[model samples]
Target: MKKAYKKVDFPTEKIRKFLEPGPIVLVSSRWEGKENIMTMGWHTVLEFSPSLVGCMITAENHSFDMIEKSGECVINIPTVDLIDEIIGIGNSSGADTDKFNKFGLTAEKASIIKAPLIKECFANYECKLVDKQLLSKYNFFIFEVVKAHVATSSKYPKTVHYLGEGIFMVSGRHIAFPEKFKPENL
Candidate 1:
């Protein structure tokens, strides 16, 4: 059964929620011995084979300078279990707080980048900036994954997604189907 509903114009300023289920990412960057981590939700996968990623790191973020200068960062995927820590990290700035110590997060060095990876995360991707064309104009940076790591125990980790207004949606149970839809190289 279907029911008719009234439609109205939406506000452009509050349209972030319209793009629901945007994955929340913890970006870790280091420059000149100063390491910082920032919570990011404005990122997306641009390519598959080379694992290209695009992220918007505004000038207001402290890690923005570290990432821009070092050209490297680790995209850490945290699970729903760390929701409180996630919120804490996002709300607090790394400029004045030692987020790693304050949040009790362990850091492990990456294979290809100088930035440390958050050991508590389920997955970590060491990335290097490959494009800078949109940096000045859109505060955007394109990166290529150089190395990747996933926790064996948390293979089926439940990730978190931002829904705006300080709310989040946790990833649900896995759904699998016949293999015909999947590509051979995937």
Candidate 2:
């Protein structure tokens, strides 16, 4: 019923490069009134009805501890203008410096979470952690979006995508494809 295939081995660095171009999300979490922000590339939408998102953070990161304690976080989607700040924040740990203050990024109170949202970001989503078993076992955190705020502007918003290490990429033109393709018939 099922076919078995031989296992293949690929270099970690090469595979990471191949999986580049993922959205760069600025994740903020607060615990015991102390807030921290970090840049994450491994995040994605999980559901639509209740609006859930999944993000993976290394256990060694300070943000991981905060998020685990607070059970909430804010995901900020930044524009291309914040590329330099993103790289700076990503490279440094919040344990040593206040990332928000260092980057001169402004923050506003979130509607549903204690974490503050980055004011300059185009979109912000307040989320509450709904699953922690995954985080404990695999360092994956799943959150349900509680509320969202978006900038009110007509101008196109550009987002930065992380490639690997120090490399970054910007969002390009938008394109849509048909659900079904009829190459031969068309």
Candidate 3:
């Protein structure tokens, strides 16, 4: 019952359509009393022990300067229900818009970082900038998660993944095979 695979030439720029990693996250930053939020999908977990995460925020984005200068930000994971807010935040700039007020999202004070957390998000990760060697060349930032807050009501979140060009796929289903893995691996 498996469909046959076919090979065809594809555009290199459009490879993200097939290799989009993880879920979309709302990155909130604060600097000099100014706060902003930007929807990001280019982040990845680089390590576990140090709780390292890497993301690329374009210099043109209003949040880029804030996060870079403040050296801290909160990465909030929103569920499928906030799809509209996610799209709105990504489409609009924080330059002249108060994203929290414009999108009707509540900003809660973070414990360690000045950046506020989006209360409606499923999880919030308080991060501090740890490395920026790649920022100048690739606009990439490396952050260390200093604190984390996650909801316990749901075992897993129904997150959304962007497939480029305004297309999104909601997270679906869960499968576990603990027995198939070694004890140490598990």
Candidate 4:
């Protein structure tokens, strides 16, 4: 017979912190000619060819509604220099205030999407919603990368990693390790 164990429920906040090293992304969406920016931490690459990305936004979030209606969005990858602005955007609501004006974020037109990209970000990916079934059910939006742009500067300043609550980590020096290690006697 199989043994059964009691299930334990972990706190959502703690679980989020454990999933660290996530990129700090500035997500922009436009609807009815109005555009807004929101900071997102729950996002990841899904595919390479015809690149795809998945982002989770709460149903109540204003940006989520806009993106659903517009069918387009821009994901801007930010460096540590924009940490303050990222936090501000994450804490505020686009429905109540103009986040761009409040956070001093500048927007530029995207090549393949109606949504604009953040000018201060290190890189931007213009995407169109490729899948919405998951989004409607779980508030998770999957997009196909239509176009991508990066700053001319080859050197990226420090990057920020979300660690739940008000905590953040800055990117450090790069290090490489051997792909495999062998035992001396083996």
Candidate 5:
């Protein structure tokens, strides 16, 4: 049975707080000899076949220009254990701070991209900028995941999700219903 709920008028601007509570990732990028890390939650998986991912990085971010010019970046998934580092990285500036050194995060060389992967993260997706059509208008970037690295020890890692303001929610228990889906869909 479904539970009853109260519907209240919500702020239009804060609607994302309820709709887009996806996993927060640390995007690492490099240009020339400089490397930086930025915390991002405004991202989504657009396709499976070619593994396409789209994200929004405001032009004001320090890593924005670096990624735009480098045409590559590594999206690292940090677990709930690294919540402090994640929040700190998001609040700090890469232009003035050496995020890797400041946050005490390890930067491992990526397989196909110059951007280093965050060693502490559970998974890392090395991506190449494939489309820029919506970039100028929305600060959105379309990337193709060229390579992926994941930890095998744990099948599921607890990740954090932003809920606007200073609050965050950590991923909870897992639920599976693969049996109910079609074989091909699995």
Candidate 6:
């Protein structure tokens, strides 16, 4: 059976919901001894080698000022088990409350960055701001991953994906067919 498609106008406000299934990330930044963490969903990988990451941090976010000043941050990836905490972190503002204390999240020191890592996250990427060309126009800041860490025993950890308007989707089953694709390089 073939399903019929209907044509409808898309709303600009909700365009991101259809264009991308962006992963949820907790960005921790520190500047002049002040540290803060902000939950963000608009991030993408720009390169594999040199590990370039581009994330959008609007000027309104408190972390923006800290990140802009320090040029250092960490992107912490959380599994589905921390869904509630992710939502809480996204809902609250760091300017008003200490998210690390209010959310009961432990801050662990990073090896190469001043920003602290979220102890509960499955993985953490210590990053340094490498470019800011898009900040004025698109609010996108490019970062280079200096150090990376991941859990050793996580067999199938699922992470959360933002679907806009407070809706979320958790990572599910995996299907792999490595032999079907030819590798140019490792």
* Clashing residue pairs in candidate 3 (N, C-alpha, C atoms within 3 angstroms): none
Q: List model 6 lDDT by residue over 61-120, tens digit each.
A: 999989988999998877777787888988888889889888788788888778998888
The collision pairs in model 6 are: none
Instruction: Flag regions of model 5 displaced more than 4 Å.
Output: 1-21
How far out, in Å, is residue 168 in model 3? 0.5
Query: Can you tell me which runs of candidate 6 are displaced by over 4 Å?
Result: 1-21
Worst 10 residues of 2 by lDDT: 1-10
| lDDT for predicted candidate 2 compared with the true structure | 0.74
**Candidate 3, poorest ten consecutive residues by summed lDDT:** 1-10
Residue 63, model 5, lDDT: 93
**Predicted model with the maximum lDDT:** 3
> Can you write out model 4's per-residue Cα lDDT over 82-168, one digit (the tens) per residue?
777889899899999898788877777777678998877776777889999897788999888777766555444466888897888
Q: Can you write out model 3's per-residue Cα lDDT over 1-186, one digit (the tens) per residue?
A: 111122222232232222234889999999999889999999877766577788999999999999999999998878888999999999999999999999988888887889998888877788899999999999999998877776655766778998999999998888889999999765
lDDT per residue (tens digit) for residues 1-186 in model 5: 111122222232222222234789999999989889999999977776667888999999999999999999998878888888999999999889999998888888888889998888877778899999999999999998887776654656677888899888888877889899999766
Candidate 4 stretches greater than 4 Å from native: 1-21, 177-186
Cα lDDT of model 2 by residue, 1-186, tens digit? 111112122222222121223678899888887888999999766665567777899999999999988999988777777888888888899899888788888767887679998777776777899988787788999988777765556234577887896777888887545557577522
For 60-118, candidate 1 gives per-residue lDDT tens digits of: 99998889999999988787778888899999998998888888887777887899988
Any idea what lDDT model 3 has?
0.82
The lDDT values for all models are: 0.77, 0.74, 0.82, 0.74, 0.81, 0.76
TM-score of each: 0.84, 0.81, 0.88, 0.81, 0.87, 0.86
TM-score of 6: 0.86
* Model 4, residue pairs in steric clash: none
Alpha-carbon shift of residue 182 in model 4 (angstroms): 17
